[model samples]
Target: MLPALAAMVFTALLPNLDQWRRHELPVLPAAADGSVTFAGARVTLVELSPAQLTTYGDQPFELPHGVMAWRAVLRLESADPTLNDYCEIALEDAAGRVYETGADEISRARTDFATCKADASPAPGASPTASASPTASASPGAAPSPTSGPDAASGSRVYETVAYFATPVGTEAVAVRLHFPSDAYHDYRLTPQG
Candidate 1:
């Protein structure tokens, strides 16, 4: 009877062991101390000091600058919701100004992560046509247009429309703040705002 009872307990705990392994698994690359990358930077989690400061190396805290993109996992340090959980944060520039980007300015591209598996290719189809219509120009140094009417759609356009593109110009700094729907999981990519 004792051996039968032990088997029942092991069977009940087998499913839970699988779930627990999935959550606390180390999936991504861990950053080492004093390591740097152009894409982003990472800091190791350490114990809080007596003055309520998290320190690493010679500095009291690690502050990353000029980061184009980054991924960070912020753990709950204390009971203070405002300061303890660093998940939902606001971005402010060096001049005490709030950094903001309007949603309307964002591109309308969709990701196929849900539908497509790892070893799948996108469905092929005919590309869309970009109609290049003729327009009149009145600038002094501008070249005069040869055509005066709307140009017909040719075989294909020189370039295709994209969600985002890079330019020579860029902002001095940018700030990303996570807000709304508290403690939600979201996957997003950041493009250079022009």
Candidate 2:
């Protein structure tokens, strides 16, 4: 009875031990370009566009008072081939405030920026046009494409995505944080010029 009780207690405490171990891991710092590798995946922040007013599909978009929308263009590359849908991406402001990307915000960005499409292929010498509908190319019965990262056929694939954040006015010294499932995260600072 004593041995059985001990085993049960050990099992109950195992998860906590693993959590403690994960907490001890250091957070990796991303480069100025917002490029970092976590869990064998490479993530790059291609652009950060902060706008007060924008047009999406000929429709105007305006932020609420004391708020501004920031469009983040990111490129992700992974050699593991398997899609990691568990990543949590957020913007951390100088005041330690975090903002997440929502579905509505993503749709707005997608409409304004054609490159935000999951399978956007701009024709040669043809400019991108804004449309309310999602880009259609998937065949019936085909698996839905990965939303966060690019689709790759080989062991490695590179894809770009756009995330929108509504932050308060006067917010500066911002950084993008990419949190992985392993509890390890990376911070990439957004420069004023870039």
Candidate 3:
């Protein structure tokens, strides 16, 4: 009976070996540490601030009454910034509810970060777009537009994006989930408020 069961298991797995090998897993940041790696880039949650503190773009992000907003500061570090892949970022609540940035007001916001994914082949002179990492701009006193990473002295550079979320006046986000280039996997990082 044991031999038959083993054989059956092997048979079931054999057909899906490729899927098993390609199976993806979540890369979660350590509880004690704030930085995690996603798509070969070191990602760090620099800060999470209340909406009152968020000043994205030239105008402050506006939301309807009874809706509150949470601002997330994401720091992406990579030697080759162009190699950074697109990242699908979402805010997760304790109830397992996820707020997708693409399907809401967040999408309409004018953010410094590039929202489009990279094109494999571009027009003659078009440059490859990196959704997760965009060239940082020099904006004085910018909240999150473009702060160079702490390791500027090294060859590496850091790019930052201010991710904004609108929730019920009293609601807050507990964690953030980021999936890049490939939807098969994600990096789960707990927020300071989590």
- On lDDT, the candidate that comes out on top is 3
User: CA lDDT, every prediction?
Assistant: 0.23, 0.51, 0.53
TM-score per prediction, in order, is: 0.18, 0.52, 0.57
Off by over 4 Å in 3: 1-32, 53-62, 102-153
lDDT of 1 at 6: 95
RMSD of each: 22.5, 10.2, 11.0
Model 1 per-residue lDDT tens digits across residues 1-194:
99999999989998667435433433232223321111121112111111111232333332234222111211111111122111222222334332222112221212011100011111123122222211111211111112222321222111101111111123232322222223243311121222
Candidate 2 segments exceeding 4 Å error? 1-27, 31-34, 52-57, 80-82, 103-155, 182-194
Residue pairs that clash (backbone atoms under 3 angstroms), model 1: none
TM-score pick, better of 2 and 3: 3
Off by over 4 Å in 1: 29-194
**Model 3 quality (TM-score):** 0.57
Q: After superposition, how far is residue 51 of candidate 2 from its true place, in Å?
A: 3.5
Better of 1 and 3 by TM-score: 3
Tens digit of per-residue lDDT, candidate 2, span 22-138: 445454667554566656656666666674444545456766667777766566565542444345556667776666555354345432232212333332333343221222222
**Which window of 10 residues has the lowest lDDT sum in candidate 1?**
111-120
| Candidate scoring better on TM-score of 1 and 2 | 2
Instruction: Give candidate 1's root-mean-square deviation (CA, Å).
Output: 22.5
